[model samples]
Target: REKEEDGLETSPSKAECSVWEDLTLEKARLELNENPDTLHQDIQEVRDMVITRPDIGFLRTDDAFILRFLRARKFQHFEAFRLLAQYFEYRQQNLDMFKSFKATDPGIKQALKDGFPGGLANLDHYGRKILVLSPSIIDRYTLVDILRAILLSLEAMIEDPELQVNGFVLIIDWSNFTFKGWGLGSLAGSSGAEQDGPVGQMWLAGRNLPMSDVEALYANIPHKDVLQAVRNSIPDTITANLVAELCDFVLIHSYFRFGDNLYLQIGRTAMGTHMAPQYANIFMADLEQRFLSFCPLTPT
Candidate 1:
């Protein structure tokens, strides 16, 4: 069938074929606007930076390893380093998560049964991976285990060249979902809530935590301590909670526009970036309303 499709003389020329055949090259051009040599040199520089940073570990010379951080920070060396450092720190703080996690693990398998988190069978138009999660499918299980399952699945997909260059999309199905499933009220006592008021805004999807797990973690942490810690990280002029809310936004500029459901689109910014600040603000506003309505501000 593929041969038949390609056999037509009306088909694209050799140059066009080559262009489509090598998506990595196109991704580099589209996202970074850099030629092959330039991208290679930049990757080398980023690799060197990661190696020299005494605070970070598991730093590899591999293109994929370096590109993850570089793409996440839009190739800004300092910003990428900060995010990379945070990634390591977060993993270290949660040691149990990385220990022997694999896609075939039983916990992950069971979580799959719950539809706790599921990866779609296809990529998006740009060859990026698509991950779908329906909160309605969650069963009576611990959030951490479910999160581990999801991460294991994502880790399995991370090495795909298409996904590496193009990145991923996360679609959260809010249809039939309510405050109970969202666990919004649960954020009040957590340290994150004291600072950010909700987990939805506290953590970036890929950078720090799985969306659901982070949400639950924020809901349950000691709010007072969390608030103070987040406050210390920001300038004195901004309210700590406000700063906390904006922090994740600064890290992740692309977000889903909330309406009947939520659809979030993300890709490598270093290539061609989408800076949807206005959409993010609108989404944040809707999120705030949800928090206020479902999770009222009462003394935790």
Candidate 2:
């Protein structure tokens, strides 16, 4: 069939045909980008490659897509695989370096004295544990779009959801704050929100969170919006309670740690990366409006 497809003038032997099949697979694997539509191929393509052409699917790469692909294979969690791959790469590199250590230059020797004091390798268990703790949620676009999508997702939950459970949860790890905005500066302690505000926003897609989990997916997903949407989706009667508690917690935690710079950092620099008074404000505002309109005349 393959030979017929290839349109060979004369048929090759069985061995040659098999070799051609192997070569075709190799090319397909190596030239993954040659066909843009190839990425849309089902998981079976990946599974077939894994079994018949391990070199095709498992070709080494540290890219996020590769990490995601591995996770989707049902082999193990992506973060765990990431850590293991990192360790494996470390082992290979270090082993190679040690083998060549005798001949390395004096400057290089000095730089790596005692296997290097200032490398990611020196990080302790606690630090490594933190690094592997949370999966990355990348919402790669303008902060405005991220915010809008989040807002809408919360809105959709009510317009959607079997359980009618209006729980919008945002789990912000410290990295979200540290995520250097595309055109935003990187002075080590900067937050993305400091540069802009919700005013004059063009569209709400990026800013709004998706109401349905099934609406979208994780690749470049604005997972941050999920929490924002939920916060905004809450009823006004309960909105004040939520804000009071969150704001109070921030103040208490801040005062305990940094003393006076506590309030100064609010709305300007995030305490953690993703923490935001603006987010709290908008959510509560939205919720309050909803409650005022819908809340029963008889108070609960």
Candidate 3:
């Protein structure tokens, strides 16, 4: 400890003193004061320049806390949170990107044509979708994951016949319209498909849901003819791939967004999407008829 403290005068060090040894303490103190005064004068000059110049920017460090304090005392109207959000977006370049898009994108230009034109409506649509999805509450990623998880659960059902989720089954009325073939089934687009396609039944959550129960549910549930409609949506060859993609998007959206949040709300009645609901029915049927266990895939 003594060896390490050799140069510390505060600790009674004995290191050799240099040039300052010949100067009086008063002279040294005076010189140090002079430098500090010079620094203060320089700072004042810049401060004065900033006050007079409109192009200069000033510190925001104390702005928020100060405003908040004033607000607490009920002095004038000040919305700190909104200001903070704007400030951060500006600082972080988020708002700048939005502005850039409005300035450069053709879509944005078309959207804003004249005095309060469709641009307002477009903004409304944006807000409407957010409100419908309630993304702020649930978020986009979680909704997508929910759909994936539902698929995993169904896969589990198929993989292990013994591992059923309460013996659930869904029934849909089918008159054995064996008239329908690969080209005739529901043409659910990307969102409706299950794993690679749609997979679900209406009553899969109920107790003692056997295949018979599923058939009963289908037989009992209200519906309409879909084959003719499906045929017209797309040609047979590409319909399969389209159906697969659409089905995936739909099932994932609904399964994931069982509840709504700004981050993840899909449009009303996920079934309304061209082929999502019907495809979902087919997917559920596949799950009950083919797969065994309905657990997520886990690494061994």
Best by lDDT: 1
lDDT: which is higher, 1 or 2?
1
Model 1, span 39-94: residue lDDT tens? 77767776666656676565355776766667666677777767767777778778
Highest TM-score model number: 1
Task: Tell me the number of clashing residue pairs for each predicted model.
Answer: 12, 27, 53
**What lDDT would candidate 3 get against the real structure?**
0.32
The lDDT of model 2 is 0.37
TM-score of each: 0.53, 0.19, 0.17
1 against 3, candidate with superior TM-score: 1
**Which stretches of candidate 1 lie above 4 Å from their native place?**
1-19, 178-298
Per-residue lDDT of model 2, residues 1-300, tens digit only: 235656755545788657755654444344332233444343234334334333233434433334234333322334334443554455465453333333144533333332221223222321110112121222233333333333333333333211121112233454654323332234432333442333313323223211212222222223244345555555684884576566445533433246654443322224353455454445445545665787565222
- Candidate 3 lDDT over 199-269, as tens digits, reads 22221321221222244332332222222233334467577556556544553465333356334433333
What lDDT does candidate 2 reach at residue 36?
31
Name model 3 segments beyond 4 Å from true: 1-82, 85-87, 90-96, 99-105, 114-300
Compute the lDDT for candidate 1: 0.58
